[model samples]
Target: MRLSDVWPVRGVELRHGVLELRPMTEPDLPTILDRLPDDLEMDPTLPRYAALDPGVGRAVALVQGYWRAMGGWSPQDWALPFVVRLAGEVVGAQVLEGPHDYGAERVVDSSSWLVQQRRGQGLGTLMRAAVLELAFGHLGAVAAISSAYLENAASLGVSRRLGYADTHTSVLEHNGRQLQHLRLERDAWHGSGRGRAVTVRGVGPALPWFGLDGERA
Candidate 1:
């Protein structure tokens, strides 16, 4: 059987204007690893633990983890990982992860990153909106949550633009230093006007993977 028939979420795709979000496939990994800049710097506002190092080895390891996660996914505990492409070129990634009872809990956590050159052009907002669309619109998520270090203004801005509100704050020790974490949440997302332009494809086959097929009826 085809992979999509076995794990239908693999077939899903989300798109808005020039930006596209789709499950990361093995074929897409090498291009992402090669095109990601060697000098790429992590956002200073993020905790050190959340940062991406600038090195070929680090990138390779990252992709290896991604592959492992995809291979091991189950309906009970899965990560809906997508590669963000702009006009057909790989530029970044967005991931929505959930626990063993995701379908019933209806909450998902998200993380994302874009290449430095693509940071300030509203692409981040668009990319995030697309995923939020998938989370709430397709997967029946009641709330989406994310975290950023207090110093990460860009990430905070995108959350705000997309209707996420500050939920709480905490501190964590990372790299021998304490970093502030700002939790954000959107509990009432209904694919609001923010991502109205975003369109999801391949969802029909994927709904069963997320246990949302009955709801779709």
Candidate 2:
């Protein structure tokens, strides 16, 4: 059997006009690594997860982590990772993660980043909207949760545009300093009005992996 037959999510894809988002397979890894930025120039308040770090070390860690995520997936808890492409070129990544019992909790969280040169052009918002469509429209998620550093205006702006509301705040220690966190949630996402048409493909084959196919007639 093919890999998608064993792990159905590998077959999923989302497209909006010239932009497309699909699972990052082994062949796509080198391109993603080559595009890694040497200097992210992110705000000091932002949390720096190891995978998002710049430099060779970060690249190695990312490759390892990506493979681990693919190998470790289960119905109990799984991460749906997608590589964002524009006109068939790899630009970045968008991800949605949730537990197997999501049907009960009805919640999922997301994280994403685009290449530095591609920033500020609203591709981030478009990428997110594609996944939000998959979550709320296809996966039956009742609420979507996200967090960003208080000083990260770009991220916060995307969340706001997508109809996410401030939920709470917390503090985390990042690189020996306290970083402010802004938690946001959207119980109602009525589309971002950004004029990008989105389409999801291969979800029907993956529905059983997410435990939703049984409910279908």
RMSD of 2: 4.3
Per-residue lDDT of candidate 1, residues 1-217 (tens digit): 8866787778888998789898888888887777665554333433233354447555755576586567766666677778999988788888888655876777777778788788799988888888887777777777777777677788888887787878677665433433333333444455356657889888888776776764652
List model 2 lDDT by residue over 1-217, tens digit each.
8876877788888987668999988898899888876643333432346654357665765676577667777655667879999988788888887754665676778878888888988998889889888877677676778887677788889988877778777776544432333333444464444323779888888877766764431
lDDT for 173 in candidate 1 is 46
Worst 10 residues of 2 by lDDT: 177-186
lDDT value, residue 124 of candidate 2? 89
**Model 1 collision count:** 2
Best by lDDT: 2
Q: Give TM per candidate.
A: 0.83, 0.83
Clashing pairs in 2: none
Query: Least accurate stretch of 10 residues (summed lDDT) in model 1?
Result: 175-184
